[model samples]
Target chain A: MQKEKPYKVKLSIMPFWSPLTPPMGIACLKSYLEQNGYSVRTKDYNAISSLFDFGGRYIALMKSYTPVDRMGNIAMVGYDVLMAHLIAYNNRDDFSLNDYHELVRQLILNNFFYEATDEAIENLCELVEQFYALLAEYLINDIKEKDFDVYGISCYSLTLGPSIFAFKFVKKYFPEVKTVMGGGIFADQFNSNSLELETFARKATYIDYFLLGEGEIILLNLLESNFKNVPRIIVSDKTVKKVCLDDIPLPDFSDFDMNSYPQLVAYSSRSCPFQCGFCSETVQWGKYRNKREEKVVFELRSLTKKYGKNIIVLTDSLLNPNIDKLADALLEVPPEERFYWDTYLRVCDMAEDMEKVKKWRKAGLYRVRLGIESGSQHVLDLMDKRITIEKIKSNLQNLADAGLKISTFWVVGFPGETKEDFHETLDLLREIKDNLYEVDPHPFYFYPSGQVDSESWEKIYGYESIYEDKYNEMLMCTYYKLNCQPCREEIYRRLELFRERCEECNIPNPYSLIDIYHADKRWKKLHKAAVPMLNDLIHSGSAIVDEYRDSIVLR
Target chain B: MEMERKGIIEVLAAIFPNQTIDIGDDDSFIDKLGMDSISFVSYVIGIESKFDIEVPDEYSLPSKLDTLNKTYDLLGRERG
Candidate 1:
């Protein structure tokens, strides 16, 4: 009574990046493919030793400099790797595949944190020599085993380097299979950055197709009809608008190794409703949309049943527009079965309601990350953040009273922000330091898709250069050489003082995970247990250190 | 409380389980093993937890943990 499934595809989440959360886009595509009666397989190669083992080694080395946290240590090491390549590149305007990979290969072998002696470098390279062969063999066998017609990869800012490595592996070994690349990184990158496309895209010539916008529909169209031409790169003349959020199926996470990630990401909404000039999130997501409350509740219920009491982070934009209905559905989850969760929430008069805040906390809302943006009303208006300081202070009190942790994000170094305006952030920090769980002040970055800021840079102001001169488009690290009021140095000093104030007020100045256990008498014991468990999961190579005896120092 | 060879190896293996360590009790850690100053502190933490000893501030220096045999003697001599 069942139709035979013939189509096979391999969706891969590459390594040397964040292991705190699984790639939700890949999981969504897998679910869609299976529902369409296609055989789908995934390679969460991020779980392997090549990435995690390297993190463990680097962490062990860097502990003397400063202690790294249990979460996001992998990404920390990845940036260090990227830095080594940048140093080797030495601002070269031209590059070749052989030279670039040679630098990467040199990094994998030696100078993880620092330059190694000849003997140590030799030992390190010999230890990882098996890794190169393993990657090639793995890709070849997987393509043959799955009888894969297509391979998809998920790329983000930090993953740009390693994703290319995986791309190369597929190109060299399984060249016949069609390679498709799609993720948040490529959404708006295809537009008018033709110089970026020309230089960056040509290096990766093996890729047959690129799906733009929401990946689910684009991927379905490509695989279902064996179609390659789409509104991507220069030649394609089609760009698909995103389907409504309710149309997307619950992500099939069975293909992922959940043990490798620090927390599970449960999606509820997409894009941000507010068009703040500072963010490029809308460029990737197109428009704001929410899944039906019942459908969202169903996804949560299934996830909870599978992984009991795991920390679930809602990977949504600035705020969920349907906050009330989302809370109502969360109430249906049994208290014991309920998972601890957090999401970005907007601050407004309605959010300041004490009764609603209490209800949301009872439904397992442990933390709420607020995009306060700036403490000064003038700067908030300039950035088009449609909220008031009074509303935020009021809601901060309400959320704290409901026994919920607060993570307020303040963006410093905004265009036209004066020193007097930055002091307002210090004033706001002093007001809520005790009640807050964390206060993160992010530096302003110039992203390619940030229209208002880019216009202000050249037209309104005289900031000439945008990104790094060489390989600007391909490398996604967003930084700018801006000539602005309250220069980066002054912003840096004020942030240091703000950090000191947080420390004085006994607040943890961390943006990663937070806990209410800090107030409990048994907090120390609970923290000790949680740290190792979290550390093991986020850096998975600890499990197989014995297998690769030369990689670590055994007594 | 004399330290045992098996216990030290077990603790070291737990921390860095992948490497083939050539142990010499008298060989300096910097000389025999390729570990740096930063990695030694982690080994000290393992030492403290495994042997039920508090590694004093002075014991944290690489000079104190220089040799395998000297380190074992120091551990057995200064148990907590």
Candidate 2:
């Protein structure tokens, strides 16, 4: 008998985060492989209960081993609870510091029972180690029957540590499995000539290939030839130029369970119009290119039909300029059968098109997260934001009037941001408080390849401050006077004042506004006092949310 | 007592008006009535000032609505 044609080589793709279940890139590759007569399977490691079990146990172990004796009980518990409270509060200004303190107290007294127990710590560590081993076993055993050729892992900034460890463990057990890593974080951080990148590539021997940019075509090519001298592939001591976006196949999310993820992920278009000072998109994709209108509508129709009026989140650089096309496509959707959708858009675009706003609402758009950047005209111009305060206010009001929840992102402390500028931002928040469902304030982050840099940043701000490790490549500047040495107390004072003003105004406090600075100064103090208790509370709340999904908005 | 009940009722009504909301002395928030997590959180915050109870960590707020009513009962017990 003729030997059966080797079963189509099976390919598995896994995401490190749960809400990351919609593996669009992986899906695109899967469809391509299937079309080419290869078997494809995708898994979201984030949804695996075993990961959470490991995480909880690991958290428990860390809490138990927390050197309470050296730190003193008051400081230790206090710091842990404080850190946890900050994480739990997570950009909500509705609650007071008193509220956070009280919640931390209760959490320490109740939920943090494991932290005080040595037996619990031991058990948790054992469970974590065992769970990870078993997880490796399950993954390896699952693929053992299929005779898989390669495994692809999607890595993001938050999921980097977990995905790296998982990839290494999987490789150790199944040495034959060629592991490939790719994603936004992997591409941004490792796809360069940095000492850090070199170290990572050298250390992680298991990760055979790091497919930069879009992985679908490159991955397919690699698998077809069985990874023998592939083009656009990065291995030890080799670099490749960025791949063209058009060359990659459209993402297929059908195989993965998208419902398990929060945020309905979709991309109407890629590439950005404006090259903002701080954006990585400009560096990654090199300017804006709108996807073909017909292709976009076709994908939307397919997703809507399959997902049953799922919330369609456009992971686009800007969706406003294409309002006419989007509106026409949405008109095809029934009013009652409408799906909730959200996207980022330029304030200037929205201000110009009130009719577009109205159409979007009718099309069942629930939320629009606008990058207002700053309240000060000077700051806006300096950042090359090119949008005015009046435009922001008008567009925000228009969106809110159209019955859509508006979340505005404000970045404070850009280089050259004066005391007046910060106040202007606060004033703007106060002015627009009634119209906004939420307002998030993020501090200026310095990343690689931004308009702000050490030389330019110092010239603008007249300060010599070392950038954080995470933001070494970008230039970040904040307006807080306390940021200057010997006056950091003033920074705390201003932050507290900002928080108080937000509370008084009933506006939601942005995530990391106060905590980011505070952590910078006394991370150890805060981490020990409040982090543990707060984490317990957030996890507990998340658990309740998960258990009672039908009762809550759930997302 | 009447004023407090009215205040609580008004807040709950503002959040969920059309739905029939039953407040019982012995009923649990999550188990007996099934208030869910987000609603239960809002409920907790809305009543924080009224009850003179401080919940420092919103995360550690009881997962079970049953546990929440017990806290309410405890507050009542202290008052009584």
Candidate 3:
């Protein structure tokens, strides 16, 4: 008998977020590897019951070493601080009812903020120490263990701090395991020249390989070549250039436990055509290119067959450009199977094809999220949205007529948006309120590129800085100069006005609009206040806040 | 079976009066009801709210909710 494949690759994808299943890239790679006769096993570390298994072990050890009563007091104080940070973070984002509860539970055991400070940073180190200790113990106690040839850790720009700790821990304990890094965060950095390359390069000591762009193609190539010097990153090598989307395989959700998620996510296309000033799609994915329509249909049908009829969320930048093709494909599927779906579509498409809009209703397209960036024509033009007030009104009305729920994503502070322009947006919203199911208005985030050049940047923020990696750029804050006062104040006024309007109309703010400014002001008062609170909560030994559990939102 | 078909038609009529609700016993939901994902979900939610019946996780619209016969069976199962 032929000997079983020599290499048994135990692939693991761990994301800090709940649904940390391997993305399409990993799924495609899995399929490719399996087809080529490599024994592959993928574990979603995100789904493992205890999010803070490492942290919890540390706490237990600490408690055992110290007096039980003193440890209890320390744990209680830590828990209180942790709860405060959880409350503050959740309040910043409008979390759903269920998400808030889950976040609280996860926070109790998992130290999400452990990496926020140097003191708490030690806790993370201890946690990792315990994690490896437990892993070794498990291998000895449970069954015969074989070493994994390569261990890959996925990282997003936002979660870089925690990721670094996790990477270091894995490398320290399992020195034999080849550590590789890949994902959107790295891909974004490699594609755009704007990212902080020096910082990444300095931090590269821990990572063995940074598989840039679509990792499936490069990773498989690297693995098949027996870890030979391939085009992709091979520690101490220059970054590999970006790859095309066509090269990647369709993502497999089969390995994931889908029941944990509330919504089913599907992608019809990659990238957006329009150059919206605030969006990073263009910078990241390059120009828009859709997967073959048949591929999307097959994926949808397969998912429905496997998961039963579930809500399908189209994770496309714009669903309207290929609306006809999508509508045709959806029509082929039974309506019951297509029960509910949501997608972002351009307003222009809706205006052109009202009948198709109606057909979408027939095809079970429940929600259409339109990016009505601003009501002012000037602001809309400035953002390069290429839509008019008339088109928005007509498209919205048509959708309503077809019995489809409409959700509008509006931005309050475009660089040139005057107070009067904001009022116009409110007026526009009021006009379309009857036709809409919800309205989400965010303060304009001055992303690194688009219409905002050096002059525009200086005019808005009184400073000009080029974004090294468009993905990692700090875009959470708004910067603009009004006749007097700060632009953030103007943004707040617009948000307040928008909230007041929603209240007057008796429409519930799904995002808890008040929390935006509340959290913003709290953070602005003392920049480090929230960070320390978060760190304490993550390092805390017990559960803390529960009253405002329903208020926290995670995106 | 006729009674169940009538119940399904009644729900569809409430949502879409302009469109005709002529569907064969063997007809598909998308081809027959002229409903898409959005309307199908709205209709499902509406039925659940109106009839006070819980739709099962496995029940999909148009395809599964297509035939009045299948819907009636699912509804009975859910209600029971």
The sequence of per-residue lDDT tens digits that candidate 1 reaches over residues A1-555 is: 136365578888764455556667788888877877777777776555333344334333333332222112222333444433433332223466444444444453322233334544333333234333555565566665546777788765445555666676677777877788777655433433424444456656767776655777667777667554544342212355465667766777787656545567777887778777877666656667788889887887777567542456788885457677787787777644555567788887666776677567655565688888888999999898888888888988877655566777777778878878877877887887656766666656553444435556645555534333333433423334457765645554555555565556665543122122222212223222111222222334223121111121212
lDDT of 1 at A294: 92
Better lDDT candidate (1, 3): 1
Q: For model 1 chain A, give the 10-residue run with minimal summed lDDT.
A: A544-553
lDDT of each: 0.58, 0.52, 0.53
* TM-score of chain A, predicted model 1, versus the true chain A, to 2 decimals: 0.76
Per-prediction RMSD in angstroms? 10.3, 13.0, 17.4
Q: Kindly report which residue stretches of model 1 are placed more than 4 angstroms away from their true locations once superposed.
A: A1-7, A53-147, A187-195, A228-241, A450-453, A466-479, A486-506, A509-555, B1-80
Q: Between the candidate structures 1 and 3, which one is better when assessed by DockQ?
A: 1
True contacts kept of each: 0.00, 0.00, 0.00
Report the lDDT tens digits of candidate 3 across residue range A1-555.
233455666555543433412244455556656655666665554443333233223334344343322222222223322322222231323444344334333332222222133334345344544444544444343223545677665656433434454556666666766667776664333333433433464445667777654555566666777766653354211244443444444555677665433345677776788776666665555557787777777777776556653455777889877766776777777634444566888898555565676566555565678888888998888787888888888888777655555667888777778877878887877776666656666665443333224235545556333212221222211122333222554564566577678656644433211222222223323222121121122222133222211122212
Task: Tell me, by TM-score, which candidate is best.
Answer: 1
Best by DockQ: 1
lDDT of 2 by residue, A1-555 (tens): 233222344434432233322556556667666656667677666444334334433443445544432222221223333323322332223455444334433334322332334454335335534654666666776666745666677665445544565666667777877788876654343544334455566656778877655555566567667667664345322233433444444566665554344334667666677766656665544446576666666666666666653456777878876756776676676544445566787887654566766666655465677888778998898788888888888887777655565666766566567788878977887887767655555445443322223335444445423323222211111111223322332333344455555566765532211122222223223222111111122223222211111221211
All models, DockQ values? 0.08, 0.07, 0.02
Fraction of the native A-B contacts that model 2 recovers: 0.00
Model 2, position A30, has a per-residue lDDT of: 70
lDDT of 2 at A507: 56
